[model samples]
Target: MKILIKNGMLVTAERTFAADIFVEDGKISRIENPGTLSVSAEKTIDATGLLIFPGGIDPHVHMHLPTPAGFSSDDFYSGSRAALAGGTTTLIDFVTPHRGEPLKEALEKRKAEAASCLTDYAFHMSPVEWRQHLPEEIKACITEEGIPSFKVYMAYKDSIGLEDDALQKVFYAVAEAGGMVTAHCELGDEIEQLRRDYVQNGQTTPEYHPLSRPAELEAGAVEKAIAMAARANCPFYIVHVSAAGSLEFIRQAQQRKQPVFAESCPHYLLLDDSRYKGSFEQTAPYVLSPPLRKKSDNRALWQALSDGTIQSMGTDHCPFMMEQKRNGLHDFRKIANGAGSVEHRLTLLYTYGVLQNKISLNRFVELISTRPAKIFGLYPQKGALLPGADADIVIWNPEKEKTISAQNHMMHCDTDIYEGFKTTGAPEYVLSSGHVVVENGTWKGKAEPGRFLRRKL
Candidate 1:
């Protein structure tokens, strides 16, 4: 099918201009000035007043994640629908294996689980345990599965976290295989001890969640992980970097020209640890790993985003219902560690980052889309609006305004962290692989099942 989008303000990571985009068979075939193409198309969209951009790409999210409390409320179908509604056409979720499970098996299971997704998706293989055959498995993931990114957790010591030795070994293997590793940086041992102390002092509450996993711990873990990755000659990506101190490590590494990238989420940049002081019902929803930081940290993160210290913005969109969050009422340690924001990430960033002048329009595109594609090996095909790129586009109505509310959200989750927050810009139309999935605030739901993206380094 052929589709033509005319008279839109074309915005990309590098430039902004007025042009008409021509898409053929799910890929952008041409870009030209208005009225340049005289041929008729199967469908023509008049984007006279819209800003056309490559669809947003969220590099971190957890859909249908299994937690001790229960599975996350949004599965692939619902989560992808919400993502499309928010102008994100692609997402990268982690494929986490159980402790001691084979990496290949975990990938297969995750693939089956994500089969219902409505937007293009890929996975980051998580190496939960180091084994003799792990290096071979990493190679297979890169060569066979076409997934070039691996992830390791520095927290969750009891289940999914990896110690320094194991992490270093995995980094070495990934480096040798020409792949990168994204680390969840947090000092698990120290945090465990701190949680025990807080409980012993009879000060257990949602507010204590951030107190236990402090900035210093996160910075320390980042420092150690960078050193390990450096020793292994691995390209390292620090995920959900929440502390100002951690940015120092990333900056120093970048100064040395090491292959290191940093990611920060909207929650860490917009919200603060103060939310933890609310009542149990209110505070429980914000209980995520590497919990929200101080206002000073939030300010530093904004500066980092501007200065290129943080390269990408991801949602880490893992949500639990209010009822599920109540499981930890008596003990904050038992709370599910995530909040739902997959559908709000793009709008929030645009409203606060661009409208508030924290970042330029081009920079906003890079943070939410282009940079992630370049870092994760999905460039051109997923993040560019140039000729020959995938026809995943968002027609943004910058003048439109809306208030975020869980009651009206498309995500299956029952709570919205940004509920009642007002935003200026929104997606007027979203096309995934040349298929119109969302148009004028309505979901078309006519696109075929999303394809599994086989990415390369």
Candidate 2:
């Protein structure tokens, strides 16, 4: 199929231009003036006042991801439904193994479950408890499965956090394989100690969650992880960076020209530790690691975003219902630690952050789209709106104003963290692979149209 999008403002991380886009068989065929077109198209859209951008590529989310709490909050169908509504076209989520399980088998099962999603997706293999045989598995993931990124946690006791020795071994192996290592930086031992003391002292509440995982702990882990990577001569990526102290650590590493990249989430930028208001709405609903920091940290996060210190922004869209969150109420340790922000990622960044003058529109595009693709090796095929690139594009109406609510959300989950948050920009038409999936603010696609993307090395 062929489509022509005429007279639109074309936006990218690098530049903006007034041009007409011609797509053929889902790849961009030409980007030129409208009158320069020579071939006829099956469809032509008049985008006089709209901004045409490459569809968002959110690199961190947890759909169909397994958890000890039983299962992930949302499945592929529901999660992708929400992703489309929010203008994201691709998501790269974690695919880690269960205790004593082979990494390959776990990835295969997770892939089977998400095979019918409604958008393009990819996976990052998380190495939990590293075994001697795991290096061979990491090589296989890169050479065979098309998954090249490896993740390790520095927190989450008994869940997936890797010990320092295990982390070094994995880094050495993945770096040798020409892949990037992404680390979840937080001090597990200190956090565990804090949790023990908090429980023993009867300090179990939503507000106490952040207090338990202090900023110093996160900063200490950041320093340690970076030093480990530096010593191993390996490049690494920091996941969900929250503290100002950690940012400084990353900055120093980068100044020395160490191959390090930092990422932050919208939750850290938009919400604060105050979200833990001693209520269910405040506590369990926002129980992610590196718990949201104070309002002062929020300003530093925005500064990091504006200055290119943070390479990419991802939505860690892990969700659990109110009832599910209740399981962790009496024991704050058991609370399902995640939040729902997949569907609100793009609009919130635009409306509240970029449009509000915290960052430029081009910078916002980089954070949500281009930079992720470059870092993850998707590049021209996934991130840019240019000739010969895939036609994963979003036509946005910048003047549309609406408040978010669970009543209107597409996710199957029962709550929305961004509920009642108003935004001015929205997607009006979305096309993935040259197929119109959403038009005129309504869905026009099926649930299983999405295909899995292999990691590019």
Candidate 3:
């Protein structure tokens, strides 16, 4: 298929200028100043009043994740489709192996599940435990599976978290394998004890969720993880940093020239812990791991993002039905620890981050697409708008406005954590690998399977 886009303001991590893009064989064939060249093709789009950018890339998400309540509502197909609708063309979800499961075996199963994705996808392998033979397995993941990044948790200790000793060992092994480690940092023991203490006094409402896992717990874990990664000399990427105190540690690490990278989410940036102040039905949806922080934390995170202390953003888009949240109605600990935002990352960021001048347009592109692609080994191919790059492009209308509502969302989940969050600017058209899958906020019904991106970092 061939397509040509003319008269659009081309925006990249570097600069923005009016240009014409030629696409052929699923890659950008040429880029030139507006009207410099002409090409006749299958499709020609007149982007006279639009902004053109590389499709958004969300580096963290959880599709079809399993928990005691059930699997996250959006599987790969639903989640990826929703992603495209929001101008995201690529996703890097997580692959978490059960206890005693070989990393390779879990990876294979995860790949099979992601085959249904509607947008290109990849994964961050999660190491739940440390074993003597795990170093060999980590190497195999890098060489054989083409997975060069691993996710380790400091929370969820009972099921998926790693102890400090185990986490350090895994960090060393991945560093040796030429891969980086992505960590979910929250003090597991402290949080566990706090939850117990909260429930013991009969305070089991959702409001207690944030109170149980305070900012100090998350910040303490960040300090410890940074130290551990520095000791092992491993490149570390922190996921879903949600606290002002946590940023102090990360900022210091960067000042000292440590190889620590981080990503924050829209919930943390735009919303606050006050969401948990409502009734169970109102507050349960905001109950996620590393619960939301105060507005002061939100302001601090925006500063970090603007100044380069944070490198990227993600949704951690795990979601369950409202009924799934009822499991913890009596005991807040039983509530599933996630909410849906996969389909809103780009819009929310553009609206608040760019339009508000918190970050420049170039920085926005870097945070959402370029930096993630570079860190995860999908750059030039997935995040760039240069000639020879894959044709995952977003034609954005700066004047478009949207009012988010769960009743109108595309994600399969019942609760929209970003419900009623009005957003400005939206994708007018989205092309995934040169295929126009979305036009004017409607799916074009292109069912072509998304290729699993094999990455090596």
Per-residue CA lDDT of model 3 for 1-457, tens digit only, reads 8999999999999999999999999999999999986787898999998999999999999999999999988999999989999989999998899998999999889989998898999989999999889999999999998899999999889999999899999989999999999999999999999999999999999999999999999999999999999988999999999999999999999999998999999999988987988789999999998898999999999999999999998889998899999999999999988988888898999999999999999999999899999989999999999999999999999889999999999999777988888899998999999999888768785669898898977
Which consecutive 10 residues in model 1 have the weakest lDDT in total?
Answer: 440-449
What lDDT is obtained when candidate 2 is compared to the true structure? Answer: 0.86
Q: Which of 2 and 3 is ahead in TM-score?
A: 3
True-vs-predicted CA distance for residue 381, candidate 3, Å:
0.3
Candidate 1 residue 65 Cα shift, in angstroms, is: 0.6
Off by over 4 Å in 2: none
Q: Output the worst ten-in-a-row residue range by lDDT, candidate 3.
A: 438-447
The C-alpha stretches of model 1 lying farther than 4 A from their native spots are none
TM-score of 2: 0.97
